[model samples]
Target: MIQLIASDMDGTLLDADKKLPPQFPALLEELYRRDITLAIASGRSRTALLSLFGDLAEELIFICDNGACVMQPHDAPIFHNLPDQTIRDVLDLCDTMPDTIPVLCGFHHIYFPENADQAVENEIRRFYLDYHKVPYSALYQTKEPILKIALCNMHGTAAYTAPMIQERFGSQYEIPVSGDYWMDLMCKGITKGAAVQDLQKQLGITPAETMTFGDYENDISMMECAEYSYAMANAPEHVQKYAKHIAPANTENGVVRTICEVLGIHMDSLRKSV
Candidate 1:
């Protein structure tokens, strides 16, 4: 039997508005009742993640910043990567590429260079303000431990920022793309998939007994590793390439439908009554 279910946020779980569906909270409450472990596999920073999860934080575990940090409710973080010499290597790249805006994500806060442009500021607000204690124009040297570093095109010209990041930091970091405007660098050998392996071992479950859902390139590792993996119907082409199944779109309550099907809830019969 499947003992856990993990899903990505943005394009996978949350709708286009970046809001979780009302039904999902209810769904999770039921999952909790069954003693099933639920977790978010996301590219979001942990602070922003907590804000999004809010009161439900107790019921979930987090694989945050594309799996750079892992945490659970009322606990010290379970897994974290410390930035050492590599951090300086990444920062030096930022220094050389002045046009490429870099956002440094920490466990509890985010820091960007003081010279962040208007577009960068707006993007930060849109993505991080709700959850993070943001420190703008604040990165001094690469001395602090960072979860992930984001690189975005200043001119908004790099069509494939994912590959571009690989060309730049591929040797030292694993660069994964979550969307058109963002590419995240996490330490090598660490990813949502790796985190799942860790979580599974702790829970006494095997990967074959797990299922996952995601809709971004960053999610591909988990999707490829899980025995049963799904991509949203609205997922990007690159995302779909890795998933074993294609589920309904998010707007249509696709996740709920899949859960009901897997758990043997008769959604069709109930829907007719409603």
Candidate 2:
């Protein structure tokens, strides 16, 4: 029996417009009734996820910052900090890449350069709600350790930024192309898959009893953590290669539809409940 369901947010669970489906709240109720736990795993920060889910955030687990931080419901967050020198090295690299904007992700705050372009800052605000514009040095002085470093390139990260990052830091860190415009860097062993394994061990839920859905390169490791892994139809062909199954596109409420189908919850009944 499936006991846990973990899903990626952007491109997997959220629609093209980045909005949650209207039936999602009701679906959560159904999952709760069946004693199934839901985890939102994403490159997004904890503050962003909390704001997105509001009150319901307290009930769900969050694998945030590309698994650099994991927060269990009602528990303190588990953080994996990047070494101080590593953070400085990445920032130095970003200095050479003018088009890329680096966002330093700490447990309590997201920090970006005060001189970043306004347009880029506006775009980043959508995912990083609790953020500050400060010198990069401030990141090192913070009480909360830096957990992840996210580089954003509105033009496209996969084609440009990601390749450079991979060539320079691939062996030293876990760099995942999180989205068309974003790539994330974390400690070597930190990944969505590792976070899922930790959760499974704590909850006594095995991979065989877990289900996961994702649509990006960063989600690849996570797909391996579940026996019933699903890649959204909209996911790139390469990303889909990691999944065990294919589901409808996120625009079609694929996550909800697949969950109902796998758990034997009738779609008609779900719609009625909504």
Candidate 3:
């Protein structure tokens, strides 16, 4: 039986517009009735996730900031903070890199440049809720635990910023290209795959009992943690190579649809309950 399901948010669970489907809550209810645990794993912060999930937030597991932080239902989070010196070094790198925007992600807030371009601010708002616009030094000095150091390059992460960061910090950190525009530097051993393993250990679920869906480079590590892995139809060519199967596009509610089909949930019968 599939006891656990973990999915990446952007380009996998959320639609093209970056919004959750209207049917999510109802689907969550059905999954709960079946005793299936759902985990939402994303490079987003927990506070941002809470806003997106609303009242359902407490009921779901969140692998936030690309697994640097994890919060399970009714329990305290398992969180890892970047070393202070590492944070400073990354900050220095971002400050010197042209066209790169660095953001300090924490358990409670995200800190970025107050003087950042308007477009950057708009993009940041799409994923963060309790974000603050602060000077670089101010952000570096924050007291909150630092989950990850995020860098954005509108030109493309894999082709530009990620490679450089990897060359410089690869031995010390896992610099995963989060999306076309984002790269996240986490502690060397930290990854979504590791987070999933931890969850499996906690829930006593084997790899065979877990299913996961994702569509990006960071999601590749997550795919390795599950025996039943699915890459979205819309995923990039490189990303498609990792999964055991392929699901329809996220706009079609692929994750939810696949869950329903696998669990023998009849949508027509579920309409009233939904």
Error of 2 at 184 (Å): 0.4
TM-score of 1: 0.87
Q: lDDT scores for all predictions?
A: 0.76, 0.89, 0.88
- Which scores better on lDDT, 1 or 2? 2
| Residue 115, model 1, lDDT | 72
Q: TM-scores for all candidates?
A: 0.87, 0.95, 0.96
Q: Which candidate comes out best when scored by lDDT?
A: 2
Which candidate has the top score in TM-score? 3
What digit string (tens of lDDT, one per residue) describes model 2 on residues 1-274? Answer: 9999999999889988888887787888889999999999999998889888988887789999989889987687889998888888888888899889899898888899887888889879878977999876665565668999999998899887988889999999999998888899999989998999888999999999999999999999989989999999999999999999999999999999999889888877767877
Task: Give one digit per residue, the lDDT tens place, for model 1 in 168-266.
Answer: 778877877767677788888879988988888888978788889888788888887677799999888777889989878877667778877887766
| Ranking of all predicted structures according to TM-score, beginning with the best and ending with the worst | 3, 2, 1
Error of 1 at 51 (Å): 0.9
Cα lDDT over the full model 1: 0.76
Candidate 2 similarity to native, TM-score: 0.95
Among residues 3 or more apart in sequence or in different chains, the pairs in candidate 2 whose N, CA or C atoms overlap within 3 Å are none
RMSD values for the candidates in order, in angstroms, are 3.2, 1.6, 1.2
